[model samples]
Target: MFSTGQMIFAGLFVIAFATAIFITYQKDKKLHAKNYKGAVWVAVAFFVFIAILFAIKYTLKN
Candidate 1:
């Protein structure tokens, strides 16, 4: 439902936001690596928990 101009503006805003985030992350890459070493494992654990919950729900349904 948005006009063409609004769509273009939204696209530009997303580009700018992504660029800013990239620049910021690049600047702090070393700090993030040092401070967040186990973050990936945490994300995996969270997904596993969600999957287990869904599997239990499906089993109960059947």
Candidate 2:
């Protein structure tokens, strides 16, 4: 069982960590948009490829 102080510290740590991450992402948000324009299509293609593989596997298994 954690002490009250430890619990409080954990809560504060989580809040600080999330805030830091949010700020960092916000700073880079514009750069990310400019540099990764085609990233979404790449991700969609990757998922489609995986789905095709799974379909082939299921077909062979049956």
On TM-score, the candidate that comes out on top is 2
Which parts of model 1 have CA positions greater than 4 angstroms off? Answer: 1-8
Worst 10 residues of 2 by lDDT: 12-21
Pairing residues by index, what is the TM-score of model 1? Answer: 0.77
**Clashing residue pairs in candidate 1, if any?**
none
Determine which window of 10 residues in candidate 1 has minimal summed lDDT.
25-34
TM-score of each: 0.77, 0.86
lDDT, candidate 2, 1-62, per-residue tens: 99999999999999999999999999999999999999999999999999999999999999
Model 1 lDDT on a 0 to 1 scale: 1.00
Clashes of each: 0, 0
The digit string of per-residue lDDT tens for model 1 on 1-62 reads 99999999999999999999999999999999999999999999999999999999999999
Cα distance off (Å), candidate 2, residue 59: 0.6
